[model samples]
Target: MDKNDYLKAVDRLNLWAKAYYTDDSPIASDDEYDKLYNAVVQFEKENPDLKLSYSPTNRIGGEVLDEFKKISHIAKMWSMEDIFSDSELVAWILRGDKTDCEFFAEPKFDGASLNLLYENGNLISAATRGDGSVGEDVTNNAKVISSVPLQIDYKDKIEIRGEVVISKDDFELINSERSKNSEPPLANPRNAAAGSLRQLDNSIVKQRKLKFYPWGVGENSLKFNKHSQIMDFVRSLGFLRDDFCKVIKGIDELKIAYKELLSARELKPILMDGMVIRVNDLSKANQLGYTVKFPKFMVAYKFPATEKTAKLIDILLQVGRTGVVTPVGLLDGVLIDGAFVKNVTLHNFDEIDRLNLMKNDFVTVIRSGDVIPKITGVFKDRRDGTQSEIIRPKICPECGNELLDEGVFIKCQNLTCKARVVSSIIYFASKKCMNIDGLGDAIVELLYQKNIIKDIADIYRLDELSFIGLEGFKTKKISNLLLAIDNSKTPNLDKFITSLGIEHIGEVAAKKIAKNYGDKWLELTIEELLSLDGFGEAMALSYLEFMRVNLEKIKELLEFITPKIQNLELKTNIFSGKTVVITGTLSRSRDEFKAQLESYGATISNSVSKKTDFVLYGNEAGSKLEKANKLGVRTIDESEYESLK
Candidate 1:
């Protein structure tokens, strides 16, 4: 390839890497990206003096760092060269000397790399691999990760490198919460882990339940002859090491390990896109040295990209609870990642404009470690002038209300639109909200369709006679549902605020707001809300505007219901003015424990800080316990906590 071709390849690969690593939205398949990257590498090799500094080959990660403080690495972190097929793996193995050399094979974690520093057995710093030589400091966020040890056995300073990842289960749970709040789902586990760890508030990071697995060391006082020995030492220090790491003898064993990992990728707790094969002997690794961006002794063998092409059958508009309308693409039935892909989300109208997507276009759909399938790109080659342009709807499909365009989103402004009302009612009765049992989506829909319930307030007015003739509604069930509705009349202040579904106000924000203002939050002005910590102008304004329009509705609703607000001033007990952090799996739920503590005048904190007076621990208590110990804060077990009560 010529210089111009190299330049173009460089630009293209950078774009793909940025999308893949930073945005979590990959435009190209892994195979295509690898091929382009290899071409760029070849061109750079041919014209060594003309290599560009900003080439994708020389970068550790493509994320833009603005939130966290930047810290320079004591030793440069390196990425591994990726090989796709068996033949390429064999060729890479042959490139190194095979005399008495063994390979250490482990799953290549598909997550963000974090470098941690320990001084005198205490964790001092945690950082991301920003550009190999510098990283963003995320020590506070890392402290909450259960698998990351807050204190180790080593008394000297050491630097351990690990991958911070969210498990598939936790990723799904987080996405489920995001969906409940009408927020866009994270693209994959890797992106979720990165985004969670980079949060400015460590409390948010704690809720993400991110785990860390140590794979290598950057700087250590202790010496080891083999990579496996290093991993063993790290594991002994209470760090999680890859359970699948194996010391294989030759290329055949390496290939076997690769095949096994690739076949069991979906079965693993964490996401692994491939396997990493490294020279086992530490001296041999040093001898092999390093490339500008990758270690010469190791190669990451990526599994084949999982992508399939399916024709776009139709486009459907999904109206969220907040009235934001999203375009979904209906695709011909195709299997991806062992699941049937019938539909993929187009995200928004801006995405439609960018893709120029249309009906009957053959588009590439990818599952990519997420349950929700996404349309990555359109196949222009298959288009034979038969495809029809997707028409943008001028009105809400459910209520016929005129649509309002708000930058990237088009929304239905009708507050009482059927779709919005149904969704809101369901949310208000959800398990996290009023906890009105038996009032599920089907029941809410049935009531709405029958014109028996028009809004959230209507739910409390339903009579048993209204459900007498409804399908599946027996007399006993109707009585039970009415009782549930009555029970929901008195809810916690946080739950009451959360059930309101104010834009950008989720349960966590609601709790924070309630904790500060108690039952008087409605009395606060927008400027006062903006002055509160963590409240931005947009969020504060949205809250004020929502209250302004819904005050009368709220007053009417209050006539039939009451919220139990916590009065911190009334609790003048022994635990008063104490900040308490809870850790581990307690006998009772965390919420129950929190309520019990708050009733005794204790402030609940999610993370351990210097202000923490006590850390209540239970079985399998993690880093927070160690952090409490390190800070010389008192820690009580569940038994001791109960004794106090």
Candidate 2:
């Protein structure tokens, strides 16, 4: 309504964008941010000539990295409209009445996407997903990636979409280097590969050893009449395509494959967050054509988020252990898997930018195990744009200290934020922390809310009688709880360090720190911490700051309770130790049979190879059983599995 309002609105959007893009944490709910963004749009709309050119609405994204040459795509790569449930996906399919149509289901890799241009069998160019329509060229760096072929045998021109991913092993190696350099370790492999590809220096990208796997096509000169044929041809030419890609001949088969892939993906080595279904007939694909954005012949079906969706009632900003204020999405209470989920983490400002979400909007949230639930993709079709955009606070919501952007995380400059203290205390008592069984989430919330427990040390002073007035504290339950708390006094060094709830430090980091410091945690100065094998500077600083507050308390607590530390002993083994395979109709359940075999240190393999020691079969055993018999893999029936057990 006024100049101050406009300035504050713009600042909020900018702050959110920076946090989301760089820190992977957001300070506003997507709906809240969207509401504010819509207000900005309305302001510009009401006053024709007063539009801000640098407004978030006009920018394709936050900051376009200047390191790579930008190129506009032949066709804009619009993101898919995700349907989280099978019934929803089936409804979408039923809307299309075309006959003889088949959908090809393939695994969706969790990695960085790349668009490649190949002219006459040689890679002409490559680009990263900078703004969807236009992107920065990284052709030279892409060439060094092992999975990306320099030259293909295909005679015609073709463009392909692939994802750059670092293997689990490579992620470990890269973290080791970061630890040695005293830099903060990368979060996940996907993030690691994305960071490596964006490096200004090609030498750094080369050192990362990223792998590329082909997924979609862009421009192609191939003469194939079917999508499956084109894919097969691409594979023959030595391009790494998804081998699990299934071609269904009819509607029933298509549905079955879709369901099968959905289940199998959970146990797969490479992460598959979703599935892509494409028309098998190439002529039909061309006939269907494209909308302004998405192709009509292809649709990507994403798996349901681990979290539940509910109406976004409101948004709240909570400061983390690092002092970054994160805007969490509050829901109109929904029950998912018997658990009530009322909030979801927004992850940062850029996500807010992409979703344009607003408060009071119905949104989706995902949560798994002990990891905090996060807001996944938003459903934009539900929006009418009346909601306000969320504004990130200029100062820390907890301590009133200005937040600092480390390009990795936002931290509170204040040494004593109550929110951070509570979060740290809660995290320290978590399962991975001291493993204090009775100190559940409900108890932690109670302790924090009651002001009785400000830190981990407070747990040591509390007695069974102290919890007598607690709502759920029955005589027997309180006795068991007290005994568990008493047993936790002798804490393992790793668990003790982990319980401190330091930023970016997990079980692994705690072990590395404990191994170097032993019992003299204070004696292990910042310099000594930075010198350790996996100690990076950012992590070292975070650890030191956390210890500065809790170190003395920890020493005092140890005097009352001696923590039992578990030394993890490592081991090595060769594949020659065990070898096994499966065949026939497994009536006993394949998974159970495999588990039984594996318990004996035997390897269960698919497709009977020369090295297979034995092939367990059952009644109605199909091609695999016959093949195993031919290959002399010592075929046996379901009874043999029972006997082995």
Candidate 3:
């Protein structure tokens, strides 16, 4: 056979392999594909120079590696903004002017993103999407994937981005085998795929049977007019493509496609959490550009959350770090979104009343974007006369104090509630607060159980000798814990305030309050607090009540810790007391610029409004720049910003 005949045979077999492995729809029998593949391999061996880049012989597995390296991507991989509902999706489409535009829609695979680099048509490197800019090299594991082409049809250097996923059947089979061997079963298909790809042994990855589906081009020498054209080109290069990817003309077609995909989601062999819609025209997408986090040209439409029904066995009252008494519904074990859930948050007493929840009642539990389960609704039809009505608690379950009703929420008025103390200590040592290492929830619970520690102050007083014989606590571990506790004694004011676990006072709010009041924040009156921006009656009242009740405790905590306050008053520059809005992409990261501006006492506002005193514009300024111009805010470029500083 001639070179042309060999090329045709290779393409035919490649398509057949893709159809059977990726699309799960075989066009030819295994024997036929194998016959053509062998013919192409023989031709390639006889005429090595005439061998095509995507010859069927290149599908053989690759060598193992001692360790995975790290590689930088040619282009940054930006995540898409998520839209939850149809209305939000419509709003996003209209924002990009759907009348003159086209869209390419495909399933958003629930798996790890992998970037493949090909040079001279040979696979050179493969990396995991580790933060977009840099990634871990997984070339050996990537080569083991049958769907991942070892050599592509393209000649020049090109980068392709795709997802690595495990089919449900393969996942279950692997788990069953592991169970037979008395090994721990993998969690889910996504986890299994990631774990398999990261294995040091390439043979283990090959055994897992992971698949790849190319969705986008990262960096390419060839230019395409539209995204659909790029997809076609990628498919021609022998890479597995998403079979359902389609081009739509307008919003109506987009809506129809979304509905179709949603309906077919259950039939898909791999997990798909949502559908990704991108602007079809590449030039238009470039013009639309991106924000600090996501591109404006595309949006992900998430499917409705998975839910399961479980019988409410009992209701447990739990105290949070803020002393709020929350109702937790204990349920019979049920699977939802691949995880077994036996409890769901009722949120408050109002939610229990809203659902009219009763013991033994069947409730619908939902696991949306959060790990915690929530009871969305009750199945009234399934409830029998044996079910008992839910009763509101009259006292705190931990401290035996009478609960105080506060409209939608009920609080344990006692600040010394044991559960509240435990939760507060845990929060204080959390990464967002004092960041005490080796202090986890279980350890905090154990300390509380043994009366070794009582409060945040007690954490600082712990001696290494106290943990001498504690389970899992060796001398080195105890020394590390004591060192962490000692290091946590000097927290910044914002972190200290956040560690207090005040209601409605998170890290951001705490930072704002601390910046405005400085060292005198604890001494601020309710009226003074109400005068501050973002402070309302409820928040002001909460602050006043907490300060008044816990003044002595606060003083005692102050004795044990040093709260470092940022002196905003020291900034007497021109930017001081000004509200600034930043637009477009600057040379440095947006976060760095924001921090610099804040250091000079300038407040950063997300949007351009009449109150904005200055607008710092950079390259590719978009709607915010137009808004700033219309509002007549003083605009400056990067050079002007440097001059001002």
Candidate 4:
């Protein structure tokens, strides 16, 4: 710990940084690195005359720049041609007679691509991909990204190109923080990252946790046979590169690689819209290159658009199982992520106000996979003379019952409302509930209309004659349904409770309550329910009211079915009486971790609150982690979780 340690400290810290950022491996623990970093800082302060441009401290942040200077890329940064379908990919390969071409496929990151300029191994400047040829110099902002190397071992000039992206979890956390500040939520991670890199103050970018990933180079001195080899060389020079990449020969291997890579969509580190397929051999790729705008050697296989512009045809009220009336938007037919979205949920009147939506107004509809489509924003500029303000409903659309206005929500309190009853039955037979596999919403509604099933008790009293005249009911289908219904007669105690469709009592709460009360569920008191970790006064009251109202119906249903309760002899642990909230990307699935923790007597809740005693978090943990820290709640990482067990 002397002046001689200066050189050693700097070298050791940078090497550790490289290991963590580039190699996805850590040579030293975070604390160990911090200790050495602190020592280096102290040494620098003592020896005030000394200076080192490449010091890791320099990467912390720099002076606020007035504006970004333009940087002309040494080599043209070519955008790839995009192919959306298998047919398009095949056409591209066939036209170029590229059946023999070895393909280099990598995940297509949904972020702003950047070109980093380096000479004599020192990263001197970085630029945003403004156009294919020119870009905005964002050197200081780029340096803030830990994954962007400060210096490499290369002797010749190179432009280490990659996309600057925020992880999905971090993006959500950022939006959560923005929500608290009354700022507009970011549309997507790509925009957030692109905006972060353009900030005048690099300190802001540093807080955003931007990561740089090398995909391709603009100008490089190294000689490599394949694109994969160049990627490896760039990674060796300390750029963050991932292994979800492949080198394949011929069209068959290319298709197989694409399928395999696409199947791993959810496992990617950052948000990716698709996969990029490149001609593998570098010299051959160069010869096959350059269309008017894009390189012929590379093409991006884009995933379907998850967000698209659509016109709001009208607004309609849709009542759910709980009788909550939600404003559903009737959208002009639009395709979003492969789903033809004709209707979208505005959620409630509050959301209607938030987006300032109107009939015939153009809006952005978003849908991810099979998740319900929603209108996130309205295009005020797109409004014309024909657009009209939507009239808010004061009554239920289905039953014409007077609605109860409850601040953010409007509800049809009438239990006899057909929509409510149908929804309730559908919810009861959901996979997490009674799990009647053959019973879906459409069938439930048909049964209700036929008057063959009206209540929970009615489901068990049915026979072959019950479904005889129903449309789409073949004998075999009817038999399968009967079997499914019979098999669901003995639902787990928690599942049965969830099937009751009680307000504010989801699977999480039901499971906790069922396990605590077991077979004595009917004996539970309001005060006892209130004692549960997640149950508040309102929830407790709802539980009591439902039990009191449904007591006779429950008794009748009990004759036809059995609710099997868990007999637990829980192993005691530190989490025995603790309320735990899980967040972020974990080594295992969150559900697996939740079940594991529950087995150790932990009460798992969906969100972070003052009541939470522990927050189990992993990589890129969101605002919950920040809230947990602020609340002074104990946080446990994966290693700590293992140790506790």
Candidate 5:
């Protein structure tokens, strides 16, 4: 490649690296990515003078973070030196004195490590482990973490350590959206959570529903210095801690706990990469402490590699939300980390070039515990010279249209890919959008498949004639669905904006845009939109450009629909600004009630508590009701809710 191509490749590599590290979701596959990466590496090696400063291979995750306040640690938080195999771990243990030792064993959670400070029973600060000694303080954002209490029960000044992790359910949900939006899928929950926490916009962080759990302490926090006592004390302070922790008396008991922990790892919520062993006794811990960075009293016991070799059969293209084409690796069947692996996300075109991977190539694959097996490395020696170069589709697989090269991604130019259509339909009928009932993904797909709907606007044109011969469709069901669709014709300004699926504009962002633009949603200039809170230059320009191109089509559709303005007069109503929680089976589905409440401009809390305005109950309410009663929140039965509605 020429110098210009080399420069371009380096720039792209850096962008992908940032997306991989900061975004947690990578746009390219390991093979494709590594190929580009290796090319840069090789180029830098061959012509050292031509190497650029922004090259990805030279960077670490130590950039100065602005989102959080910088702080100096009382003690250096060194990364645990890893031993990948059992023999290596045993050797390390034997390399040091082992007599009179009691290891306090716990799981090494795969999440973002955080350091928390508490003084006079209240949380003073929380920071990420940026380097060893200094970190970005994220105390304000940490306050939103329900697992990390703002005030602990303990009175003494204390510093605790923990990891922030996004739950599997949330991770899947986020990744699904990311895939739809043509963004790279997050590799795992750990990266997903870390990325979410580091987002400059707190609202995005809020939407992520990030959680934290205490794992270690920075300085003296309790009367006891032993690992077991410290854990118990930390738990008592209303912080979530690893549940599998055990005080093992000796190596035999330690081995037992390790086995038990490994077994229990299957049932744990957070991902466990390995087990951490610390001295149980305070005196023993202090005596064994300080070997450069890691405490001699503690060592991480990593699990054996569950990796195996697999053959690259072929590459498949998949379309995402924003029409980005993704490459998926079809591999020879292999068992990895207890799961069968047939396919793995290849990421993007850049990845294919980087790995120098092609069809029929042998690759080393590893399932990093219970997740998908990824091609970590390629075995060039195994190739028999019959390997075929996999071609990335120039058109979208889902919707056959010439793809648009959007710098980082090869996106579908088709405006109506099935995935995009489904997402758009869902968004249009969503609670914060048009608030249509009985309209979800299944119904949307069916409507599209049966040729009853072509777009969101087409939903209004559906009748019983078009609905005939569909699965499980009854007269009443059809009538109700039609009524819901018809009712959704009247959309609110905020809802209309949200339904547009404008880039970076969700419900909250939509509301801000609508309010700022007033009656001139389309008339508002890009500069005007960019001035709105949380609106960036890129997002504003993207929205404006999309609107400018699609405005006429939208305007024509508007003739068949009317803007549904809620009684903004109800702003002064009793429940207007108050947050409410509803538990138990409602007269309608929980989603329905949430929709109804939100329509009237009320905030919905996921959990019941004292601050909750009211807990709307139905038949057979569970612990939430009991908790609400204890907290003295107003309890309203279905009858009361019906009367209010």
Candidate 6:
């Protein structure tokens, strides 16, 4: 057959595939489609260069890889904030002015998040959403998944981010097959789908029968007025979109939709954690922007938590890193949300007082997913005379010092408390703080017990000889840990502040304080801290007092620790104060060029429009190039762009 015949076969097969997988309307019988597909595959094998990206042959598994490579995302993939109660959802909807807002609601599938990048109408890379900004390349594994489109007509450069899920029936079938093979059943569908995607062999992925559902897009060149338009765009490109996805008008609509979706949650083929509510207006959503952890314009209304009743046996006191004496309840072993619960934190005395919990008295423990269990109710009627009221401790359990009752919390205020010092050291070495990789809770405790590290500052004074005398501290392990400690000397300023574990200040508050003050973060005033996001009077007061008492110690640590400098300055350049659109692959990744242009005070946009000042082009540029030409937007190649820079 000639090129025309091969093209016809490929188009027919792709069309039939889209109809079957996406629209649920198969046009041709499986046998009939297979005959044509096999023929096309044979022709493509004979004429490899003539093969098209959209061909049906790509769906059959064949590719193999030794290991997955890391790739950076064009933009950050922020996770949405979750609200479980109707009141919380209502507050989220009403938090901002929303008179003109329309919301997009879709099932929040519980599966591995995947990011698929396409350029010039072809799938270029597929990755697991690893830490939002970077992911492992899974292009070969993705090709075997039937729902993931290999090509689309509208693509310039776009990233389709979605959930890679295993349907209920498919998951059960897979587990049953494993049982017959005398293999252990997979833990759950979510884990099965996640593990399958990372398998080095594509044949294994093909057997998993995974499905892809596009929840959202990352960076894309196509212009969208509303989020619905983006859904439409992906649907047109042959992705299997959620059937329940709809646009909700207001709070009332959102409330109704949430209830309806919750009722039908189990009916879904794929497991859903909840439903996402996003502002439909693209412009309004962008203006709302994001917080350190979540997008302000969007929220997830999580389904009702898996609540199971458990009995609280006793209450115990523990000292935290900040010397706060917290109450923890000892619960009778109970299972909630697949995990066993033995103990739950009481946070403060106020929580215990609120619940009126007593030792040996039955109390209801509420747990959601991985969130720690809490005492929500006390079975007063079932309580026997043997039950004893929980007593608030008058002295610190670790140091035997008189406790200072500061409203909700009780503190040790003893700088040398063994428990507090050890916990503080652990916090300082944690991933979110200094990120000292090799220093963990066990190592910190061992070091503290040996009198090697008594305080955060003491960590800097430790040497190889300190661990040389200890058992299980191998030479290489000690060397790596020492290197990690040395590396943490230059942690981000926000993280360093968070490592201090102030009573009221957390990561978000610490970030706001650092970003606002930058290099002068140490000089932050209580008045200035009060103005930052999420900072209240109590937090500001706690921050000020902590600094006031430990400023000298912090200064001493600063001699050894240098926080990362936060400086973002726009340079004066020809592209300054201009709107620029970048399309097509360049000599380097688009991210590098975009960062360079942004640093030069230029606004980098996705789509070409009348407002666009310059459209940067490279080899294999697609619709963006054409649109720029017709719109009379100035086009510049690599050399011209270099000249401009």
Instruction: List runs of model 6 lying over 4 Å from the truth.
Output: 307-367, 370-645
Give the per-residue lDDT of model 1 (tens digit) for 320-405.
88899999999887755434568798889889889889899999887754447888899988899889989878899989989998
> If the candidates were sorted by their TM-score against the true structure, best first, what order would they fall in?
3, 6, 4, 1, 5, 2
| Tens digit per residue, CA lDDT, model 6, 1-645 | 789999999888888988888789999999999899889988998999999977878777867665688989998888677777778777776777765689999998888999999998899999998877889999999998999988888648889999999987888788779989999777667778899999987988999999999988888876779998999878888899778999989778888998898888667788887889999998999888886556889988877765667778877899988888989999886754333567888888898888878888777777654456787788899977988878888899898999898788788998778888888888888876788887899889888888888789988887888887797777777888889889989887877888888877765466667777888777778789878645689898988888888899899899899988665344778898788899865655776787678657676787889999999986446689999999999999877988888
> Model 3: residues >4 Å from true position, as ranges?
1-72, 83-103, 117-156, 169-211, 232-239, 248-253, 291-293, 305-310, 333-341, 365-373, 394-422, 435-489, 503-561, 569-645
Q: Candidate 1: minimum summed lDDT over ten consecutive residues — where?
A: 58-67
| Stretches > 4 Å off in candidate 1 | 1-305, 337-339, 368-370, 474-480, 567-645
lDDT of 5 by residue, 1-645 (tens): 768989999767755654564345689888988899888888888888987643655432223233355887776776665555456556656755654566677788778988888877767787888877888876656655545665556777778888898766677688778879998666667767777667655556656767777777877646775778788878766565555777776556766777777777656766677888766777866766665435666777766556788999988777755667888899987744323468887778888888898899999887754445677789999989899888767777787778888755888767778867767777777766677887877888888887778877787777888777886677877888889878877777777877777766655556666666657777888778878755688878878877887787688768777775442333335666677888865535777777567556566787986679988876446678889889989888867776775
Per candidate, the number of residue pairs that clash is 0, 31, 0, 0, 15, 0
Tell how far residue 147 is off in model 2, in angstroms: 1.2
Model 2 CA RMSD to the hidden true structure, in angstroms: 26.7
Q: List the residue pairs that clash in candidate 6.
A: none
TM-score against native, each model: 0.45, 0.41, 0.63, 0.51, 0.43, 0.53
Q: Select the stronger candidate by lDDT from 3 and 6.
A: 6
What is the C-alpha local distance difference test score of each model? 0.81, 0.68, 0.82, 0.82, 0.71, 0.82
**Is candidate 2 or 4 superior in lDDT?**
4
Candidate 2 residues 169-208, lDDT tens each? 6676887898899987776666677888887666677778
- Greater TM-score among 1 and 2 belongs to 1
Of 3 and 5, the candidate ranking higher by TM-score: 3
For each candidate in turn, give its C-alpha RMSD to the true structure in angstroms.
23.4, 26.7, 9.6, 25.7, 26.7, 15.3
| Candidate 5 Cα errors over 4 Å, as ranges | 1-66, 180-182, 308-364, 367-645
How far off is residue 458 in model 4, in Å? 72
Using TM-score as the measure, name the better of candidate 2 and candidate 5. Answer: 5
Give lDDT: candidate 6, residue 581: 90
